[model samples]
Target chain A: MRVFQILTTVSYGDAVSNDCLALFELLKTSGYETYVYAENIGKQAERMGVKPYARLQKLRDDDIILYHLSTGTELNERIKALNGRKFIIYHNTTPPDVFVPYSGKLARLCSCGLDETRSLKGTFEGGFCDSDFNRQQLISYGYECPLKVRPILIPFEDYKKDPDAETLEQMGGDTKENDHKIKNVLFVGRIAPNKCQEDLISLLYAYRKMYSDPIRLILAGNPSGLEKYMAKLKVFAGELGLEDIVFTGQISFAKILAYYRSADAFVSMSEHEGFCVPLVEAMFFDVPILAYSSTAVPETLGGSGIIFDSKDPSHAARCLHEILNNKELRDLIISEQKERLKFFGYGNVSEIFMKQFKEFTGQ
Target chain B: MSTAREMLSDILLSSGAANVDVPVSFDDISVCGASSADGYLESLEREFSDRAKVIPQYRDLKEKLGGALFGFYINHSVEQQNEINARFLDVLREFKANNDEIVRLSNRLKELESRMDDNGGIR
Candidate 1:
C-alpha cells in the first residue's frame, strides 16, 4: 500500500524531521511505497531521496495519509477532500499556538483550539502519540479517538570506540594515564526558548560553586532564532566566571557521535517536548543523563536518568552533583539503559507501525 | 419725388416698383412710424443670432446624450447591472425586498445536498 506522509518542513536539526526520516526508512524496508508532501523539501529530504507532491489531490483511495503534528490548516482542506484512510502521528506536546504565539486571529477563524488537546479532537481517525503522557493529555481533553501511545525508537548505530593513545594525545586528552579527565557535559538539540538554555546555565553556575574542579559544558546545536537567548547565556556564564563553557555551533553527525562518546554525561532543561531524541542517543552511548522532569522528559528517561523538578535551580544543581560524583550509580544507570535499549530497535518499532497501518487500511 | 420726402421716395422708387411712403421728418420716422418695425427687426436679429450661436452647444449636448445612451445599452446587457443602476432604480428597490428570500432558499438547497448521502462522497 502507498503511504503519504505530510509534514511542515524537512529541515535537519528538527526532531520531527529526524523521526519522519527514520519512519520513511522503516516503511521502505517493509516494501511499501512512500511519498512525502510538504510546502518545500529541505536538504535532508533531498539526501534521503523523497519525492514531493505539491498537493493532496494526487493521493488515491488505497493510500494512507500519515500526518505529522506539524500539519495545520493547510491539511484541513485537503483532508476534507481525501477519499483515503487518514491518521495523525502527534510528535509535539503542544499545538500551533505554542509555536507561533501571534496566531490568535487565525486560530479563531479556523475554529482550532489555542491549547494542544482540544485542537486534535474529531480531526483524525486514529492517532499515535509519542508517549503515554501525551495520550493521557488527549483523554483529559475529551478526545474519543483510538489512540496509541508509542515511544519513538530508531535503529542504533554501533557505538564508536574511543581513539587510541596516539590519537588521544593529539586531541589533548590524558593519553599516558588512560583517563578521560575532562568532565564534559553535552546538550544536543535546537537552541530555543522552550529548550531552557538560560535555566541550564543557572544550574551550571550553581554546580561550579559547589565544586572547584573544572567541568567543560559544551552547548552544541544550531541557534534556532534564539541567538539573543544564547548570547545572554554566554554573558551570564562570564559574569559567574565560568567562561570555559564551549559553544560548538552546529556540527556533523559524525562529530556529534564523537562528542557523545567523549562527554561524561548529557544534560537538558527543556520545558516542553513530546519526546527527547538526544536523551535516547545518550542512553545508546551509556552516558548518564541529567534532565528536568517536565512534559515528556520523565517519560522518555523512564528511570534511566537523574530527574529534578525544573522550577528550582538548586534542586537541579544537587542532582547534577550526585550524578557527576557517584561512579557506582552512574554505571548502574548505564547498564539498565543498555538493556532497555532493545525495545527502541528499528525492527521492533517498524513491526508495530506496520501492524497499525495494515489494520487501518484493512489490508 | 422732387421734395425731401419725395427725394427719399425717388431713392426707393429707383430700387423697386413698390410705393415709398416716406415720413415728412426722418426723426418722426425713427421714433414713431418706424418704432414697431425697428423693434421687430431687432428681436428677429437677436433670435436668429442666438439660434446660430446655439448650434455647436446643441451638438455637444447631442454627443453627451449619445454617450449616455450607449452606456445604458451596455449596462442593460449584464444580468445584475440593471437591477443595481440608479436609472433602473425601481428594479434595485424590488431586488432589496426579495434578496432575503433568495438567500434562504440557497441555504436550504445546500442543507438538503449535505443531507443526501451521495454514496458517502464529499461535496
Candidate 2:
C-alpha cells in the first residue's frame, strides 16, 4: 500500500516540514510508495522533490494518507474526501487572540483552522499528536478516535554532523574579544507575537539592571513575515538601552550550531508553543534550559529543565541569574536534560511511530 | 466660547481689578474647546464605561479588515455585518449627542454675549 503526507507549506528549517520529509524517507526505505505534497513548496523542498497536493485524487482505497494539520488550508476539504485510510497528525494551532493586533489575517486563519479541525471529527480513522498537550486539545475539539503521542521524526545525526566549518570559524572569531565573563543567553524561534520576544526584552532589561557585567542576548530566528513586530522589538530594546542584543534573523544551520555551542543558557519566554524542538536541541548541546512553564513546553522538557511560573521581568531576571551563576545547578539541569533527551531519541520515537502506524494501518 | 465666569475672571485679572470672589462652578468652563472636548469625552467614557466597552467591537472589525489574511478574508456574514452596523450606529448616536450639546452651548453663549453687549456688560 502507498503512503502520502500532505501539509500546507513545506519550507526548510521548519519543524513540520522536516518531520514530513523525514517520515517520507523512512517510509520509502521500508519499501512503501511514499509521496510528499504541499500547497506552497520552498526551494529546499523543491530540490528534495515534492509534488502539488492536487495529485491526491490518484490514491487508491487501501492506501494511507497522513495530513499534517497546523493551520487553515484549502486542502482540508479534499483531505476529508479521501477514499484511503487517513490520519491527522495534529500540531496544535496558536490561539487567534495572540495574533489579533499583529496580523488580523493570521488571527482569522487560526480561527478558521480551529473550526476546520473541529469539523473533522469522524473523517479520519485515528489521530497522531506530537505531544500529550496537543492530544488533550484534540480531545477538547471532540476527536474521539484512536490517538497516539509521537515526537516529530527527526534526523538528529544532521545536528551532530560537523557544522559548516567556515560559519563556525566566523562566529568563533567574532567571540574571541569577549572576556568570557559576558553571558551569552540564547533563544531560537521565529520572531512573532506569540513567541513573545517582547517578554525576552523585558527579562534582558531587568537582567542588565541587576548584573554588573554586560550580558549578550542572541535571538536566532527568521522574521520574514513579522516585520512590524520585529521593528517594535528593536524599538523596545532601544528604549531599554540594550546594545548587546542581536537579532540574527534567518541564519544558516551552521550558524545555529555555533550559537548553540556558544550559549551559556537557553532561555525561552514564549507564551505559545507546540512541542518546542529548540528546547531539545539545546539539551543535545548540553545547554541548560530555563523556559516558562506554559503549553507543551513543560511536557516537552519531561521534568528536565528549570520551569518557572512568572514571566514578570524581575522574577525572570532573577531566575536567569540563578541558573547561570550556580555551576552546580547548571550541571544538574544539563544532566537531567541529557537523560530526558534519550526519550526523544530516534530509536525510541521511531519505534513508537512505526508500531502505532502499523497497528493503525494493519501493515 | 468661554463661559461668563471665565471671561469675567480673565477681564478682572488682566485689568488688575480688585478680587471679585465670584462662585466658580463646573459650568464656568466651556466644554466645546479642543482640549475641553477631549476632557468631556474622557469624562463621558469614565461615567459610562459600558459605552466605552462597545468600542472594541468596531476596533476588532477594523483590525480584521486591515490585517486580513489572503485566504480568510471572505466578506462578513449578514449577522457580522449587522453587529458591526449596530455598534457603529451606537457610536454615531453617542457622538451626535455630544455634538448637539456643543452646539447648544455655543448658541447659548452667543445669545448671552449679545444681551451683555446691549446692556453695556454686567452691572
Candidate 3:
C-alpha cells in the first residue's frame, strides 16, 4: 500500500514527527511504500538519508493520504479533490478550545463541549483519539463519530536497553561505589507554562523541605519561547536553596534516552496532553514515574506510575516519599509497566494503523 | 406644495404623532408661506395622485432588483477580497524578482532625461 504521511515539520523532538518517522520506518520494513510530506525537513532526516516533500502533487489513485491534524490549510477541500481515500489522524484533542472563537455564539450555546461544536464545523471524514477516555469525552460532548472511528491506543516502541552501569559511568557517576544512592529525577519535554514547569518547581521545593537528602532534578527540554518562565523557575529554585536542579537545554534524543536510563524516576506535571509519549518511554526504560493526574496522564500511566493531584504539592511530595521509601512496590509497578510496554510497540501500532487505513478505504 | 398646516397634519397622522387640535385651514398655513390657498390644495392633490400611480411599481422593483443587486455586491466583495490577497502575494513575488533590472531601468531613464535636457528641451 502507498501511504502519504503529512506532518507540520520533520523535527526529532516533536511527538508527531517522531511518531511519523517511526511509522514510516515500520511501513517500509513491512513492504509498504510510505512518502512523507512536511513543511520543513530538519537536519535529522537529512542525516538519516530521508527526503520529505513539501507539496501534495504525486498522489495516485492507489495512494491514501494520511494527514495529521492542524498541519495543512483547506484540508477538507483538498481531501475532496483527492481521487483516493483520505484519512485524518487527530493527534490533538477534538473540540479544541482553540476553535471555540471561530464557531460563534450560537454554536457555543447549542453545543455541550468544544469537540462537538468542531465536529459540526465539517472538517474531517473520520477522527480518532489515543484512548477510550478521550473517545468517551468526545461522545459526551455530542460528537456523532463512531467508536471504530476513534484512534487506536498506539504505544511507543522501546529503544534498545542500556545497562545502568554504562549509563551511570557515562554521566560520570559510580553507582557501585556510591551504593546506588543517586535519586535522579528527569523531566523530558518542552519547558512551557502548559507543561506546568512552575508547578514542578513548587513540587521540587516541597520535596526538598520534606526530605533531608538532596536529589538530582534534571529538566531536559527546550525552553520553547518560555525563557522568562524558565528564568523565574531558576530564580525560585535558587531562592528555595534547591541547588541540585539541572536545566539541560534541548539535548539530542540519544542524550534524552541516556537520562531516562540513568534516572531513578521520571517526573512530569503537564496540565494537558493528547498522549504522553515520554511516559511510555520512561516505562520502557523501567524508571518509576511520578506525574500529575490530569488529561491523558492517568490514562497513560494506568496503575504503572505514581499519580498525584498536582493542585496539592503536599500530596505530590507524599507520593514521592512513598515511591522513594518502598522498593518492593516500585519494582512491582515497573515490572507491570514493562509487561504493558508490549502493547505500544512499533510493530503493533503500525499494524493497527494499517488495519484502520484498510478499513477506512474499504480495501 | 401643500399648506404647512395640512402637510404637518398628514405627516403627524402618517407617523402616528399625537396631541394637536383638528380643523385648521389654508389661511392658518399662509403664515408658513404657500403660493396661494388654491395652489396649495392643487399641489397636495397632484402629489397624492402621482404617489398612487408609482407605489406598486416601486415596491415590485425594490423586491426584485434591490435584492439581486445586494446579492451581487456581497459576492463581488468576497471575490474582490480574494483577488486582493492574491495580488498582495503577486506584488511580493514581483518585488523579489530582478532587483538589478529595476535599478538599470531607472538609470537608463535618468540618462535619457539628461540627454533630453542637453537637447532642445524636448528631444
Which is the leading candidate under DockQ? 2
Q: What's the DockQ of model 3? A: 0.01
Which of 2 and 3 is ahead in TM-score?
2
For residues A70-167, what per-residue lDDT tens digits would candidate 3 score against the true structure?
32233323444555445556555333342232222323432333433344334344545666665565456465644343333333433563444545
Off by over 4 Å in 1: A55-57, A71-73, A93-120, A140-142, A158-178, B1-123
Which model scores highest in lDDT? Answer: 2
Q: How many backbone clashes does candidate 1 have?
A: 0
**Regions of model 3 farther than 4 Å from truth:** A46-53, A70-83, A93-123, A133-158, A161-178, B1-123
For candidate 1, lDDT tens digit of each residue in A243-287? Answer: 777776776665666667666778898887778888888888777
Candidate 2 chain B lDDT trough over 10 residues, lowest sum: B17-26
Residue runs of model 2 more than 4 Å from their true location after superposition: A164-179, B1-123
Q: Give me the chain B TM-score of candidate 2.
A: 0.34
Q: What would the DockQ be for model 1?
A: 0.00
* Predicted structure with the largest TM-score when compared to the true one: 2
TM-score ranking, high to low: 2, 1, 3
The superposed Cα distance between candidate 2 and the true structure at residue B13, in angstroms, equals: 64
Q: At residue A346, what lDDT does model 2 achieve?
A: 84
Calculate DockQ per candidate and list them: 0.00, 0.01, 0.01
